[model samples]
Each structure stands twice: as structure tokens, then as C-alpha cells.
Target: MEKLTAIIPVFNEQDTIERAIVSVLFADEILIVDSFSTDLTLSIAEKYDVKIIQRDYEYSASQKNWAIPQASNNWILILDADEVIGSSLREEIQSILNKKSTKTGYWIYRNNHFMNQAIKYSGWQNDKVVRLFQRDLCRYEDKRVHAEIITSGDLGFLNSKIDHFTYKSLRQYVEKLNRYAALQAIDYDKITDKITAYHLLLKPLWRFLKHFIIQKGYKDGVAGTVICFLQAYAVVMRYANLYLLRKKN
Candidate 1:
């Protein structure tokens, strides 16, 4: 059987980190990469026999990428602290370990919950992510806000869902969007000098269509509507960050 390591990165997630840690207890080892959290996140992680590593906050990709090299196992499952894996996914993971298949990665579906509602639309449902992978073959891209894990080989998918508690309220959503917009602005600012009206205008409309219609977000009702609107807002806000950057200089 291949050795399995679970990698989780957390920051100020005192309310959710414990449950996330407990859910993945069956792994051979759990490695937590944490930002300097002001809450009891460290204490909760310590209670679960977790090996903790401290890092300054950056992009999600940067933090997790740092944790990857430190893992003892060749096979690692990367999970966000807010993500929850159900019982069936756990068993499936063990099955894969026993088999030690040659597949380089596995994509798990994420059922996102916001405000106690399992959002069906807004292009948030059935989000598949490459959570399980061979440590040597996979690496995260260097994007600030929306970094993706890129693997060199074909991937597999797990049938069960990983719960993503994405947002609690509108304030939380706005707060996070501001942070992400700042990150995205920095990334874009470095890559390109200026933002055009094309990106500022067309991209947001496309986001709404992609989520609300193409992704069947409309079927998700109010949750989906709100998600699509917020997504469009996020696109607009990213460009707004350009204004901030320009003004500061």
C-alpha cells in the first residue's frame, strides 16, 4: 500500500478546523500548514496528532505548495481546512491506498454550502477538484486567488462529495471577495500593465452567463441567483482594484 499524507492549510478557522481534522483521521499522517491564526486553531490541530507547519499568509496555492515538499508520503491528499469529507469518501481513499493504483490524481466533488443552504446553482455545485494525487507529479500553479493544481498524468474521480462551507453571510462574501480581488489585482498588475474596458465589462457578463445558464445555476433558485450576481460583482471588483493600485502610485 502507498503511504498517504493529508495536507490541510488553515487560517483563523477555529470554528471549522477541528471537524476538518477529525474527518481525515484515518490517514497515515495529517500535515497542517497554518497561517499565524489568532484563534484556537493551533490548539485544536494539536489535539488531533497533527504535524503542524507555520507559514505567513499568501495565496492558497503558495501555502499548500510549501506544504507539499514537507510530506513524508509519496501520495498526498490536499484539503482546505473548511472542506469536509464524508464517510464514503474516506473508505474510497483507503480502497485506493490498498490498491495503490497508477493514476496520478483523483478529483472529488464539492457540494458547497452557504448560509446553511447547499447551493445548487451559481455554478458552485458539483465542483470537482484534484484533491488526491502523487506528490511528485502534482504541483499548484502560482495564481494568487484561483490557483489550480496541475498534474502530469490522467486523473480519477471519487463519487462522494466534499462539503464546502463557502460563505456564512453577505458580509463574509464581500470581505473575502475584497481579499481575493486584491490578490488578483496584484497578480494581474505584475503580468500586465493596465486593465482594459474589455476585461472590465465583458468578463462579468460572461461570468453571469457561464454560471446562471451554462452551468444550470438557475435551477438552484435564489442561492444560484445570488451566487451569479456576486460572481459578476467579483469580476467588476477585480478591476476596481486596478484603480486602487493606480491611485496608490
Candidate 2:
């Protein structure tokens, strides 16, 4: 059998830290890479038998990259503070570790929940992420938002899924959306020069249409409608921020 290490990166996640740690207790080692959280997050983590490391966070990809090599095992499972590993997923991970697998990484699907409700659509239905991977064979892209894994070997998919409590309330969602938009704007400013009306208007409208109509966000009811609209709004905010950056420079 191969040893597995679970690495969870968090910041001010006192509310969900314990649950996240408990879910990944199946791993041989649990590593909590905290971003010097000024809350009870570290206190809650101390209660567990996991190794805790603190660092000043820059971006998600950089944080995970810095933490990955510190793992005691080659097989690594990365989890977010708000995500829970389901029982079936736990068993699946164990089963995979038991076998002689050829793949270097596996993409797991996420069952995203918003406002305490499972979002069946809203372009989040097929939410998959490469969380389980060989530490030596994979690294995340250097992106401020939506960083993807770059695997050296072949990748596979898992049957089990991770339960992600993405947002507990509308306020939380908006807060995160704003933060992400800011980061996205900074990222965009590197490659983009002119932010025009097309970016602020047409792009956001297309985003809403793609999610609500093409992706069938309406199937998820009110939560879906709100999510789709807010996603488009986030697009507008990102472009607007970029426009502001352009104006300043």
C-alpha cells in the first residue's frame, strides 16, 4: 500500500477547518498550510494530529506549489477549507492507493452547494478538479485565479466526488466574487491593454446567456438564477476593474 498525504490551504477558515481536517483523516498525514490566519483557525487545527505550517499567501497556485514538495508522501490529495471528502471518495482514494496505478493524477468531480442548496446547474454541474496527484509529477499553473494543474504523466477521472460548500450566503458569495474579480483584473492587466465597452457589456451579457440558457442554470431554480446573474456581474466587475487600471496607467 502507498502512503497518502492530504494538504489543505486555508485563510481565516475557523468555521470549517475542523470538518475539513476530519474528512481527510483517512490519509497517513494531514498537512494544514495556513496563511497566518488571525482567527481560531489555528487553534482548531492544533486539536488535530496534523502538521500545521504557516506562510504569507500570495496566490493559490504558488501556495499549493510551495506546500506540495513538503508532503511526506508522493501521492497527494489537496483539499480546500470549505470542501468535504465524501465517504465514497475516501474509500475510492484508499482503493486507488492500494492498487498499482499508472496514472500520475486524477480529476475528481465536485458537488458544489450554494446557500445550503446543491446547485444542479449554473455551469457548476460539471465542476471537476485535479486534486489527487503525485507530488513529483504535477504542479499548478501560475495564475491568480482559476489555476489548473500541469501533470507530467497521464491523468484519469474518479467516480467519487468532493462536496464543496462554496458559499453559505449571498453576502459571502458577493464578497468572494469581488475578491476574485480583483485578482482576475490584476491577472488580465498583464496581457490586456484596452478595456472597451465590448468587454464591460457584451462579454458579461454573453456570460449570462452561456450559463443561464446554454448551460441550463434555470434547472437549479432560484439559486441557479442568482448564481448565473452574479457570475455575469463578476465578469462586468473584472472588466471594470481592468478599465480602472487602464485609466490610472
Candidate 3:
């Protein structure tokens, strides 16, 4: 059987870190890459039988890329603090480890939830990520937000899903979007010389329409509608922040 290591990178996720660690206890090694969280995150994690390391917070891609090679095994499973692997997924992964698989990576779909309710739409219905992969065969794209894994070999998909408790409340969701907008603004600043009405107005409106109408966010009801609007707001905030960032520079 092949040994697998689970790498969970987090910062200030004390409320969710323990559950994340507990879900991956099946792995031969569990490595917690913390960004010096000034909370009970470290103390709670210390209770688990897992390897722990600390580093200053940077962009997501860089942090994940730096930790990938440090894993004890070549086969790696990366899980976020807010994601939990279900029993079917765990069994499927164990089955894969018991054999010589041809694929270098596997994509796992996420069942996203907001305020304890499952979200079936709002452009999140088919949310999938390359979480299980060989450490040597994959690396993340150089983006601050929404980084995709770049793999050399062919990838396959797992039938089971990961339960993603993305946001506990509306306040948390808004704060998360605000932080993402700020990080995304850094990348936008490289290309945007100026912000105009098109960015501030049309783009946000289009974003809202794309999600709420085109993507059928209405199907998910109130949560979906709110998420779509917030998504558009995030776009506006991104460019607005880019404008300020450029001005400061």
C-alpha cells in the first residue's frame, strides 16, 4: 500500500481546524501549515497527532507551493480548513492507494454550504478542485485568489464529494469577499492603468446577471441571490482597491 500525506494550510481557523484534522486522520501523515495564527488554532492543533509548521502569511499559491514539496509522501491530499472529506471519498482514496493508479491527480467536487444549508446553484453547483495529486507532479498557478493546480500528467475525477462549509454567516462571507477583493486587486493593478465607469458600474452589473440570471442563482433561492449580488460587489471592490493601490504606488 502507498502512504499518503494530508496537507492542510490555514490561518486563524480555530473554529474549523479541529474538524479538518479529524477528517483526515486516515492519512499516514497529517501536516498542518499554519501562518502564525494568533488564536487557539495552534493550541487545538497541538492536540492532534499531526506535524505542524509555521510561516508568515503570503499569497495562497506561494504558500501552497512552498508546502507541497515538504510533505512526507509523494501522494498528497490537500484539504482546506472548511472542507471535510466524506466517508465515500475516504474509502475511494484508500482504494486508490491500494493500487498502482495511472492518473497523476484526481478532481474532487465540493458540496458547498452557506449558513448550514446546501447551496445547489449560484455558480457553485459544480465546484471542483484538484485536491488529490502527487506532490512532484503538481504546482499551483501564481495567483493570489482562486489558484488552480498545474499538473503534468492526466487527471481523473472522484465520484465522492467534499462537504465545504464555506461560510458560517453573512458577516463572515462579506469579510471573506472583501479580503479576496483586496488580494485580487494586486493582480489587477498590473494590467489596469485606470478605473472607469465600465469597471465600477457595467462590470458589476454584468457579473450579477451572469450569476443570478445566466447561472440560475435564482434556483437556490435567497442565499443564491445574495451570493450573486455579493460576487458582483466583490468585483467592484477589486477594481476600486486597484485604483487605490495604483494611486498609493
Candidate 4:
């Protein structure tokens, strides 16, 4: 059996840190990379026999990349503070480790919950991420948001899914969106020549259409509709911030 290390990066996630840590207790070791959270997140994490390391967060990819090499095992399971591994998924992971697999990485699907409701659509229907990988064979791209893993070997999929408690409330969703938009704007500003109508208007509309219509967001009901709309709004804010940065320069 391959030794597994669960790496979780967190910042002020006191409310869900314990739950996240408990879900991954099956791993041989649990490593928490914290970003100097000004809350009880660290305290809660300390309750468990997990290794905790604090670093100033620059971006998600950078944080995880730095922590991956410090893991005690070759197999690394990257999990977020708001995510929980289900019993079936845990059993499946154990089964995989028991077998002689050649794959270097595995993609896990997520069942995301928004406002305490399971969102089956809103472009999040097919939310699959490469969370399990061999530490020496994989690295994350240096992106501020939505960074993907770069793997050296072939990837496989897991049948079990992780339960992601995405956003507890609308307020939390908006707050997170604002933070992500700021990071996105910084990234866009470097490559964007100038803010055009496409950035502010057409792009947002297209996003809404893609999620709500093309992605069948309506099937999830009001929660899905709101999420799709807010996602589009986040896009508008990203460009708006970029435009402001251009004006200041």
C-alpha cells in the first residue's frame, strides 16, 4: 500500500477546518498549510495530530506547490478546507492504493453545495478536479485563480465523489467572488491591452448564457439561477477592476 499524505491549504476557515481534517483522517499523514489565519482555524487544526505550516499566501497554486514537496509520502491528496471526503470515496481511495496502479494522477468529481443546497447545474455539473497525484510527478500552474495541475503521467478518474460545501450563504458567495475577481483583474491587466465593451458587457452576458442556458443551470432551480447570474457579475467586476487599474496607470 502506498503511503498517502493529505495536504489542505486554508485561511480563516475555522468553521470547517475540523470537519475537513476529520474526513481525511484515513490518510497516513495530514498536512495543513495555513496562511496566518487571524482566527481559530489554527487552534482547531492543532486539535488533530496533523502537521501545520504557516506561510504568507501569494496564490493558491504557489501555496500548494510549495507544500507538496514537504509531504511525507509520495502520494498526495490535495483537499480544500471546505471539502469533505465521503465514506465511499475514502474506501475507493484505499482500494486504489491497494492495487498496483500505473497512473500518476486521478481526477475526482465534486458534488458542490451552494446555500446549503446541492447544485446539479450552473456550469458546475461536471466539476472534476485532479486532487490525487504523486508528489514528484505533478505540479500546479502558477495562476492566481483556477489553477490546474500539470502531471507527467497518464491520469485516471475515481468513481467516488467529494462533497464540497461551496458557499454557506449568499453573503459568503459574494465575498469570495469579490476576492477572486480582484486576483483575476490583476492577471488580466498584465495581458489586456485596454478595457473594451467586450470585457464589460458581452463577455458577462455570454457567461450567463453559457451557464444558465447551455449548461442547463435552470434544472437546479433558484439556487442555480442565482449562481449563474452571480458568476456573470463576477466577470463584470473582474474587468471593471482591470479598467480601473488601467485608468490609474
Highest TM-score model number: 2
**Every model: Cα RMSD to truth:** 1.9, 1.1, 1.2, 1.2
* All candidates: TM-score: 0.92, 0.97, 0.96, 0.96
- Candidates' C-alpha lDDT: 0.86, 0.93, 0.92, 0.93
**Model 2 C-alpha lDDT per residue in residues 1-249, reported as the tens digit of each score:** 899999999999988999999999999999999899999999999998999998999889999999999999989999999999989999999999999999999999999999789998889989999999999999999999999899778999999999999886688879999888988998999888677888888999999999999999999888899988998999999988888777888
Which digits, one per residue and each the tens of the lDDT, describe model 1 over residues 193-213? 567777778999999999999
Instruction: Write the residue-wise lDDT of candidate 4 on 205-233 in tens digits.
Output: 99999999999999989899999999899
Candidate 3 regions exceeding 4 Å error are none
Error of 3 at 187 (Å): 1.3
Backbone clashes (count) for model 4: 0
Model 2 weakest 10-residue run by lDDT:
240-249
Runs in model 1 deviating more than 4 A are: 190-194, 246-249
- lDDT value, candidate 2, whole model: 0.93
Residue pairs in collision within model 3? none
Task: Name the candidate, 2 or 4, with the larger TM-score value.
Answer: 2
Residue 64 Cα positional deviation in candidate 1, in Å, after optimal superposition = 0.8
Clashes (N, CA, C under 3 Å) per candidate: 0, 0, 0, 0
Candidate 1 accuracy as TM-score: 0.92
Model 3: per-residue Cα lDDT at residue 132: 93
